[model samples]
Target: MLDSNKDIVLDELNKVFDTIDNSQVDQMVEMICGAKKVFFVGVGRVLLMLQAWEKRLNHLGIDAYYVGEINEPAITFDDILIVGSGSGESIFPLSIIKLAKKYGAQTIHIGSNSESSMKPYEDLFVRIPCQTKLYLKDEIHSDQIMSSLFEQSLLLLGDMVAMKIVQKKDIKDLHLLWKKHANLE
Candidate 1:
């Protein structure tokens, strides 16, 4: 790609960000804050991103768990499950969503399509505005390939929600997060 085209690509990304559902973002933050225990599930890079969010939530002193990790525990009525799947059709995550629902957990699904099967499973749906492999040739599109746009937006979305939580709780010290950091080197 030429240097001159970089601005155009960025502008396109900005367009997607500009129209993101602010209400959904607010609801996500509230769900995280209100959940007694928060568990996350996704695949590939999306999973990696959720792991990053798990660490941040721990930094904020929230009980955050990554699904499929050895330390993950059973979900219950007081808990919440957060899932990110750009395609919204991955069997592993959908299965986990079902199990979480059976356990009476509040589920939040973040993906591109509001019509995704995951929709019915979640209590709240966060529809990210970007292209996924499942709908690349459709009207909506992304300059970046595959699910990059959705993944990127998901990362930022998580970060923004974490920041809001930190602010709401008045968590001001960097040392506090450091204390929660793993001690075994």
Candidate 2:
């Protein structure tokens, strides 16, 4: 029974990948590789995905941050704001994206629903087809992890982009930071 469920999930994911527009992926990579600063955000489980992206971007020498109340600064025209939303209709994150665009920043939206109205406002959209529990009033359940398999796929996508950034920039020392930061006994 578990295997059956797993197969179902894989099949759904395959469909999602099959339909994805490869050009959109190129747009995302191009934007990230060229952006001076990148800010990533998501409301709930999607936030976890964005957080991972932030770490990877930092490693690649890009300024990236997760949105919060710490007056984290705004994204500029040369900046890219990466947002992760399963539904793409989530209000808070959507609003943030809008504001970022208003400030002249390019936006990249990652979501499970490609048809979301939010896509119209973004410069790049990477859709991961999966049903997300739309909590009442556009809220997200903190307990629900937004389809583990799909989220994992998004993480892999982010990593791929990060690696691309490293290659495009021809980073001089990939492991130098690790060596300096490593806690040696």
In terms of lDDT, which candidate is strongest? 1
lDDT of candidates 1 onward, in order: 0.85, 0.74
TM-score per candidate: 0.90, 0.77
Give per-residue CA lDDT, model 2, range 1-185, as digits (tens).
88877776666556656766678887787888788888987876668877888877776667788888375776789898888887788888989898898999998888766667687778887866555654334222222244665576677678777776677787778876464332676
Model 2, clash count? Answer: 0
Candidate 1 weakest lDDT stretch, 10 residues: 136-145
The most accurate candidate by TM-score is: 1
Model 1 C-alpha lDDT per residue in residues 47-80, reported as the tens digit of each score: 9889989998988889999898998888999999
Candidate 2 regions with alpha-carbon error over 4 angstroms: 1-19, 69-71, 134-146, 177-185
RMSD of 1: 2.2
